[model samples]
Target chain A: MEKATEELIKETAKDIFFKQGNLHATTQDIADAAGVNRSLLNYYFRSRDLLFEQVYNEAVQSKRSQLDEALDADLPFREKVERFIDVYLRDMRKYPFKEAFLISEINHKDFVLKNKKKSAKLISFLDEIAAEMKKGTIRTMDPMHFLVNLFSMLSYPIIMSPLYQQLFNLSHTRYENFIDERKDIILQSIFI
Target chain B: MEKATEELIKETAKDIFFKQGNLHATTQDIADAAGVNRSLLNYYFRSRDLLFEQVYNEAVQSKRSQLDEALDADLPFREKVERFIDVYLRDMRKYPFKEAFLISEINHKDFVLKNKKKSAKLISFLDEIAAEMKKGTIRTMDPMHFLVNLFSMLSYPIIMSPLYQQLFNLSHTRYENFIDERKDIILQSIFI
Candidate 1:
């Protein structure tokens, strides 16, 4: 029961911070969201900053693990990218503000990744991208730019959805449909 | 001198919020950054919210005008894109956190754009993109996706610089060079 309560609190905090885009949500807010007494929350986490740090670390780890899984998957290059987009967009739909939260934390808190070295998976993924380029399947450029371009298209529209919905005059349903259409569009844009 | 101080406070707030990515900066922080007393800041803007409103409005206005200039320029489609990239990147280099700030405000504050309608300029630009597709100069996709892809490639790298610098193990100078190289790369990715 105690473990469940603690997990509830952490999950509630993630919902507030990641799903709702409320970077300024207070401990009281989390406690309210979790239906727990403020003292109980404090008892479990000690303080708001500690709670936030745990959530932040978990968010980073989850994202890194997702990337690693996609990169290390033994699939064709195109299929690998398709799998990556599927996983990434699934997470984005569930937690639209997560990337925004991550970026904000990095900007405001001087957050540093614990694993500073580039992962072997990522290095191999770059090599795979380079190999694909050699086959003239994708545009020839620095492998890093290919990665950047892939992530940029996949993440940016979702991150800026609030603003883009207004700018493009898209209803919520319409905007979602537009994003749904992007899977193929993105694939086509990359390949030839 | 009075006008100068007021301008100084606004500019300093912009520097803090847009350049430094300190979205949570207090009025006292802004005043300190401006080298002005809190009372002086209040004297000019009446309240911190009012000061923020002014800065936010100006940032939106400035970005809109820049886009308008690029879209409405008489240059060829390719040159116009090149010019847009140049201007957008130049502003981004100066105010790296501006888009993050804007998106956060929209998400957290229920900030509706003053101009909610799709601009005539943006519509024409979309038309222009469609025309380019017909001419076989670019990949065929929803014009909206085209715009999203363009802005994504342009902005995401800069916005995620703090995180990306660590993730990719890029030195500050090397990252800047990477971004500098993106203009040509973005053009190539867009134009067939």
Candidate 2:
């Protein structure tokens, strides 16, 4: 019973904080959303701040692990890059505000930085690119720039879709298709 | 004196609304920030919402015109693209939250969509891309896809810089430098 309640609280809290953009959600708001009493929140997570921290940490972890595993996987360089973009776009689509919420909370005093473990994951991705560059499969450029370009291509469309939709007068279907259309262009941009 | 008070109120309202993220800023907040009584805000703009609308409209107008004039100019295609990216990066730096803020307010129940004038501006940009495509200077693809790539490369980094900085361990200077390095690669990606 206690385990179920705790999981319920966490799921509800993630929905509220991440999906709903209720960064200021109080214990009552979360408890109410979860359909549990206020005391249950305290019993489960102790405080609103702690609940938020746990949720945010899990979100960041899950995202990093997704990328780390994809990049660290044994696959052709372009294939891995394509899979990375696909997973990222799907995640962004699922949690439309995830990136925005992350940006807002990234600098908060209570936000913990937990990136010491990511470097080990990044090395192989860089090495793969270096090998390709040596073979002239891709242009000789700083791997960091290549990574940044790849990420920028994937994320900006998702984040700024609303504005661009209006600018281009695109219907809802066209907007989604626009994102679906980026994989080829992004790969061509990365490889020579 | 009247004109000065109106300008002061508008400036304060923008600082409060956009920079400070004070979407719910009251008349009192604007008056306090501008060192004027709440009455002058209504006296000049008749309501806080009107002042906000005017400021938001002017911002969009100025931005569209900047792009319109730049694209319509008779510069070489690559040079024009470089200049546009430069101005865009400068603007994003000046108002880091402008795009985010615009996205949020763009869906406000009372928000007006004024994009009819922009199509005229965008036509020349599309024509230029088509010209390049015909000349084989750039690959043949959907003009829309080409544009989405161009914008995604330019914007995603600025919008999601905080997350990437933390993940990549970039200092402020390094982050800025990363954006500066993208221009050459982005142009290369667009043109053969």
Candidate 3:
């Protein structure tokens, strides 16, 4: 019962924090939204600040784990990348404000988004990239550059979707479609 | 003298808004930073909100003008693109927080960033992109997709520099070097 209540509070907090843009949302707000008491929220998170930090960390960690899965999957290199893009696009649609929140956090705050475990995963992903380069499935270049290029293509449009819409006079529907069309566009650009 | 003071206030407000993330910085703050009195700021801009909107619009307009110059340059398509990348990289380094500030404004606020003149500029850019495709100087594809891909590559790395640093374990110096080297990587990927 306690674990379930704690999970509920955290999930509700994530929704309210990321979706609602309530960075300063109070514990009372979380409790009210979670249908629990304030004390229960405090018992789970100690403080609002701690809750926010945990939520941010969990978000990054979850994304890292998903990348780990996609990169570690026993698929061909291009297929693996395509799967990763699929996951990335789906997540971007799910959490439309995520990149904005991340940009603000990274730019304006002293919050250290540290993850010792995820560093290893990043190295592994890079290693997979290097292996793909060796196989000539991807162009022979610095593996790091390839990784950066792939990520830039997958994320740039989605992160700047609104600006793209504004710049191109694209409605929301067209903007979303533009991003949806990027999978093949990105893949075609990357693969030989 | 009055125009200079107005420019000073505008520049100071931009510094506080983008660099310091003080979206709600007061007229007094701008005046103090500009070394002018609050009445002078109000006299020039009429109100704080008006000042902010002008600052935002002017930033967008300046960038659009820069792009117009680059796209209109009488160079070959590839060289023209390289020149634009150089301009973009220089501007991004000059104003690291611009994208973050833009993202926050676009995502969280009701502000509409409108510029009727710039819509014509975008059309010209697309026309240029289409011409390049027809000449086989660039890949044969939808001009809109090419523009999106080009802008995505140019802006994404700069916009997400801090996050890229965290995720890739890049120190500030190394991360900068990575971005510096991307002009070729991006251009080569785009052009035949």
Candidate 4:
């Protein structure tokens, strides 16, 4: 029952946040949305800020870990890049508001910073890619720059979905199709 | 004097919203920070949400129009991409919090459904790009995918600077250097 309530809170809060944003969303709002007592909101998470952080951390960390694992796997760089794109798009679809929420929170004073470390293995994997660039196995470029652009091209769309959906009149199906085609586009943009 | 006061209000509101997420910020707080009467805020802008939309529209439209004009200029695709990166980085440096704030606003329900028609020109540009892609002059890729990744890599660092600064232990000088090199990196990532 504890696990169930926790799950309920997560679902309710996520829905409320994406709909209303963090500022307008009250604890009572979350409690009412979750069909639980307002006190239970505090019981599960001490404050709205804390609750926001919990969701933010969970939403962000899950993607980070998966992408890290994909990058760290003993695969060719090209294969790894493809896997990274897949993992990123899949994750983006799952957590549509995570990018915007986290970006907004980055500048929040009430947002007490959390120690969400990047996986060491991912960093080392990135270093290896840099080494390959230096050795001319991959194109000559800064790995940091490459990584930033690569992920940005893939991830920015989802974060900007509300904007893009407006601009392109993209249906949900078409938007997913757009995401599906990014791996080739990104690779050709880089490895060529 | 009216212009100066309006500018002050905008500047103050930007700082507060940047420092605290929109939920925690109030019009009263913004008015106080600007050293103006609370009534002045509404007098000038009608409401907090409308005032924020003005700020966001200015922020996005400013960079966007400049970039759009550049894209229309008779430059090679590679040079245009480089110019886009340079211009984007420069604007991002000038208005560090603008994109995050705009993105946050875009996610809110009040704006999302209401403002769909206001974004047609931005979508048209992407459509034009996709049309170009079909002619095989540029590499084949979904325009939306290309767009998402490119913007994410280029823009995410700025929007999420506090996180990156902490995690990377990036000094101001180092961050500037990273941005300086980003134009070439972006060109390389996009150009075959």
Candidate 5:
């Protein structure tokens, strides 16, 4: 029962922060959202800051693992990218504000990644991108820029959806459909 | 003297919120940063929320004008894009957190943009991108995606610099140099 309650509180906090984009949510807010008393919430997490730290660390770990899973898969480079985009977009659709929340935490709170071991998977993926360039399958540039470009296209539109919807005069439903259409557009843009 | 003091408070708030990424800054924080007394700061802005609203509105206005200037220029489409990237990158280098701040304000604060007039300039720019696609100068896709891709490539790296610096194992100076080298790479990626 205790473990279940703890998980419930944490998940509720994540829902508020990642899905709702409420970076300023308080302990009481989490407690209220979770249908628990504030004292019980405190008993589980001790403090709001401590709860946020756990959530932040878990978010980073989950993202790294998602990248690792996609990059380490045994598939052709293009197929790997396609699968990665599918997985990433699905996740973003569920938690559209997760990236924005993570960015804000890092920017405003001086949060630093605790793990520093350079991912062998990411390095190998860069090499793969470079080899694809050599074969003229993709544009030749710094591999880092290639990765940056890929993620920029995938994540930026979702992160800035609110602003773009207004700027483009798109209704919410139309804007969502537009984003749903970008998977192919992104692939064609990347692979010449 | 009074007008100058008011302007100083607003600018100081902008510096703290946009440049420093200190979204939680209090009115006292702004006053101290401006090297003025709290009462003087309040005398001009009345309250922190009011001050933030003024700053936020001005930021949005400035960004719109910047886009209008770039998109309305008489240069060819490619050169116009080049100029937009250059202007945007220069602004981002100076205020790296501005976009992040704006997104956060919109997401968390229920802030609606006061202006609703569809930009004729941006509409025409989209038409230009479509024309370029017909001319085989760029990839053929939804022109909105073209703009999204362009802005995404331009803005995401800067906004997520802290995370990228860690992920790529780059020193600050090296990372900055890498970003500076991306203008040509972005152009190449888009122009085929």
Candidate 6:
């Protein structure tokens, strides 16, 4: 019951913070939404900032985990890159605010600077991929460039949805199909 | 003289908004930074939001102009794609906040949705390229996918700078070199 309640608080806080942003959201709002007293939120998470950090970190790690698994699988590097894109895109859909939350945080000077765990796990995974690419298991390209491009192609639609809708006259109603249609286009763009 | 001051104010306001965000920045902050009085800011732009809108619109227009130029050039579709990447990257460096500002505004859902001049220009250009691609002047891939990937490869670095740094353990000191090196790798990613 304790774990369940804690999980409930976290899910509610995550939704509120994502929709309202960090500064705009209040602890009481999270507590009320979670169906818990304000003190329980602090008791479980310590503070709102700490709670948000947990959520953001988990979201980033979740996506990283998916990517790491794909990279670690017994597949050729070319196939890995293809599969990585698929996995990354699928993971991104699960966390719609992930891009926006990340973008807002990244503007700060030390936003992700202190998170050694995330940094290490991701870099090690990248290094392994880079090593394979170096051996020509993948086509010749800078691993970093491939990494950046792969993510951008995968994440750009969600991050830049406003620009797309604005420029293309696409309505909010069309967003689902628009994004679905663009997936193949985005993939082809990178691997064509 | 008036045009230059208007330009200066817009530049200053954009820098402030892009770096500090909407909540922390004040109109006086923009005015003082631009070496003008608050009244002058109001006289010229009416309000902070208006000033921001002007800069945002101009930033979009400038990027679109470069894209249209490269895409509409008489070069073949493949060459156009390469040139588009080069020109877009070069121009983006001049306005680092373009992506961030746009993303934030998009998140807020505060901006008016209207047809961008660039949209018409770009759609026509892409349609023409699609025609050529259909004729086998370029390899077979959906045009929209080609576009999504091309932009992702080119723009993802700026858009996701924080995530990139954290995930890869990259230092800000090496950012320029990192992006410069990626150009070739990104180009190859598309071709292969």
Best candidate (score: TM-score): 1
DockQ of each: 0.69, 0.36, 0.38, 0.47, 0.66, 0.38
Candidate 4 residues A28-139, lDDT tens each?
A: 8789888889998778777777888788887667756776678777887778777887887776677666666666655555555665565677578768788778766567
lDDT of 3 by residue, B105-187 (tens): 65443556563433676687788888988887667667888877777777777777767787777787998899888888888
- Tens digits of lDDT, candidate 6, B3-57: 9998888888777655444433568877888898889988888876788778778
What is residue B149's positional error in candidate 3, in angstroms? 1.4
Model 1 chain B scores worst on lDDT over the 10 consecutive residues at: B106-115
Report iRMS (Å) of candidate 1: 1.7
Give a tens-digit lDDT track for model 5, residues A1-192: 489999999999999888877777788888999999999877987887888888988888888898899998999999999998998888888787787777778766455665475699999999999999999999899999999998889988998887898899998899999999989999999998
Estimate, for each residue in B1-192, the C-alpha lDDT of model 5 and write its tens digit.
Answer: 578889988999888888877767778888999999999866787777788789988888888898998888899888899999988988888887787778778866465665475699999888999999999999899999999998999998988887788889888899899899879989998997
Provide the lowest-lDDT 10-residue window in model 6 chain B.
B16-25
Pairs clashing within candidate 5: none
| Candidate 3 Cα lDDT to native | 0.74
Q: What TM value does model 5 have?
A: 0.96
Residue-wise lDDT of candidate 3 within A1-192, one digit each (tens)?
Answer: 478888899989877656654444568888999888899877888887787778777877777777788777788767788899888878777765565566665544355556343367568778888887788766766677887787777777776676777777777797778887888888877886
TM-score to native of every candidate shown: 0.97, 0.82, 0.83, 0.83, 0.96, 0.78
Each candidate's fnat: 0.70, 0.39, 0.33, 0.47, 0.62, 0.42
lDDT ranking of the models: 1, 5, 2, 3, 4, 6
Worst 10 residues of 4 chain B by lDDT: B112-121
Error of model 2, residue B155, in angstroms: 1.6
Question: What digit string (tens of lDDT, one per residue) describes model 4 on residues B29-135?
Answer: 88988999999998889887789777777766775586576566566555666666777777677666665666666655455444345345546556666766776
lDDT of 6 at B63: 65
> In model 4, where do residues sit more than 4 Å from their true spots?
A18-23, A110-119, A134-137, B15-24, B74-76, B113-138, B143-149
TM-score of chain B of each: 0.96, 0.83, 0.80, 0.74, 0.95, 0.81
Model 3 residue runs over 4 Å out of place are: A1-48, A113-118, B1-6, B19-48, B113-118
Clashing pairs in 4: A23-B23, A148-B153, A152-B149, A152-B152, A152-B153, A153-B148, A153-B149, A153-B150, A154-B149
